[model samples]
Target: MDRQFSDRVEAGRVLAAHLEHLKDRSDLLVLGLPRGGVPVAKEVASALGAPLDVLVVRKLGAPGQPELAIGAIASGGVQVLSRDLIEQLHVSASRLATEIEKQLKELDRRERQYRGDRPFPDLEGKTLLVIDDGLATGSTMEAAVRALRQHEPRAIIVAVPVAPSHVSSSLLSAADEFIAVERPQSFMAVGQFYRRFDQTSDEEVREILAAHTHSGE
Candidate 1:
């Protein structure tokens, strides 16, 4: 063990340990921000005995640096871009629009692949727990919260394994409750805390959802 845990499974176990209090909420729903968030959320849902679903979100990456998100787009055509980053990088409207269109296509493809004819669960008057592997710029998470708010969830709880303190602070108003196990002061990448931070595939996401749904039934 090189300090960090072995994988998302271990991370989820640790995450579940701290969330024992939520195990008994009657109307609780755990929604993972796929595709990386699904694995971790699976563990949390399993431990908490809560129904699990996914919230689709895509990062609008700056040209030449796909990992550097200039903004993020979520389901239902919701987007949140950093104005400062856009002005600083001199990103043009045409470029941002192009990126958003590209990511929206991706988001649609993923939604179709993962969901098929399965309907999204009703969020009205339900306690929603949004799970992600970690939080970085918080743009994607913010977009997700904004999108989810339209559905009128009783409350929105953001749960993650790791995040910077400032990012967590910024999300405090967006989410009804924020829970992060580690708020590292010197965080640079979300992968730093994971021993096996591998890319998650669409098939895996579907399989996890199917298996959990069947098992729960």
Candidate 2:
């Protein structure tokens, strides 16, 4: 209920402590879920001395309730839907198609805006640490994990500052390992845990990635 972190940067530092074992592992790679996740992940990558990259994912929220995710789409055309939610909502096929198309366009635009000419990092046989500011539904993270699976990462670890205690089972099953700094029972939203939860912009995401890339060079 109380503010657990001053901001995403602080959250990342706290998470890095718990993930200290992964520090300096050549096989490890840190992939952040942009745009909010990038700042947190930047700290994690710095702490771990690993390469950092972004995994673009868009949440497909339910009709009329944009905050409630019905599914998610990730890079490389990987899509994951909650069939139960879809059936329960009775979301029309046309509506779902339109949403998916819209999100896919946004994903593509983000990829171009963030990475520019740089190619996506290779994940084959690597240990991936998927970082996010926090998790609420876990749908977007699940989509990211499924997409990464196609590249055959040796392992996938989903790391976040906070998440609902109830989403643990699903996230754990989705990733090889899942770590949450705080799993509160009374979790309402991810932003509530932070004292300053400002929206992360596309420009910020680009700058962070550029800085990380330069530091690596």
Candidate 3:
């Protein structure tokens, strides 16, 4: 049985319901994985009275199979690669280096475009809630957790609307807490759980962030 929501807003609202108990946590911050995670994060932040920010993670796609992530990189040059995958796929050292450089450039470009001059929130001793629309491959989410761990947050929680049971289980070990609205046995793709899985544009992301900034001030 495949249950789909009306849109990201609905998913956010639903996911937020699961996190309502954390509303009173003063040191909580929400970081979304753009460009799909911002809108969802906004709703979560609004509901929880937590500040919202973006966590840009660029996937280092495998050679030829671009969708398959050989490795992933997050902001501040946090990189994680699967050595087994690299060895099995026979990815050359030079080729891996090239992809990493490309991903780093993209990570920086996205940070500038989406969050120009906005300093990353200080996660030290804060309960950081990392939100995304959904999880697939789980590599990107793992990379995000790894990057955030560098900041020494008091706790880390990975929350999403939907993810495969297996992927969600694997991700639990990476974060202090992992919560998802639904973990189906036959999870196919993230889009399958959303009726409106439209590609979020950069302009939309900018608008949302700007609106939040203005409202907060």
Candidate 4:
């Protein structure tokens, strides 16, 4: 697993180039999945001269295996679970419910913290580009697309810098367009593809959003 990107910023720039066709489109909106996706998305928004915002999504990790996502929850009460995984692991209903509740609370907190009094942007009949640093199981992005559908976006595009080949394929039908910079066959983890895959903090997400808002103003 060789590092394909120097950092998220560089990955965003590269992704922006791939998405050059969308530059300056009035109907285009770029929403990044925080907090890592926000930095990558900031670069995309700047490159395309498009409005930038955050789409808060939290992965529902399996109990005692925090890195393995059994599901994901997004804003607007959208919850998606990998039933097959749950069945395979034999996760108890009670345990799953508890995880969902915990994640929902975090989701609510993130929404309030990231957007504050700002209203969610209108997406009706618009082309939405949902971005992340990378895709692993694609569960989080799946939840995001499902939630955004309620807003009636004309099209949804999931863009990432790197993802496993199989994971990217699985997401193709979930979004109007699925774009991945590198779909390595020997994929290990999203972080393995980036030289600087540090944890993205809440303050970083807030600062990026604030800068975007100020620039728009």
Give me the candidate number with maximum TM-score: 3
lDDT of 2: 0.91
Candidate 1, poorest ten consecutive residues by summed lDDT: 1-10
Which 10-residue window of candidate 2 scores lowest in summed lDDT?
Answer: 73-82
lDDT tens per residue, model 1, 1-217: 1246578888888898888989968889999998889999999999999999988988788888887777787765567787899898899999999998998999889888887778778888999999988888887887788778878889999999988878977789889999988888887888988979999889999999999998972
Q: Which digits, one per residue and each the tens of the lDDT, describe model 2 over residues 13-131?
A: 99999999999999999999998999999999999999999999888989999888888887656688889999999999999999999999999999999999998877899999999
Better of 2 and 3 by TM-score: 3
lDDT of 3 by residue, 143-215 (tens): 7887788888899999999988889767888998999999888977899999999998888887888788888
**Residue lDDT tens for model 4, 62-90:** 99998788888776566778899999999
lDDT against true structure, model 3:
0.87
Query: Which 10 successive residues of model 3 have the least lDDT summed?
Result: 70-79
- TM-score, one value per model: 0.84, 0.88, 0.90, 0.86
Report clash pairs, candidate 3.
none
Candidate 1 clashes between residue pairs 3 or more apart in a chain or in different chains: none
The CA lDDT of each predicted structure is 0.86, 0.91, 0.87, 0.88
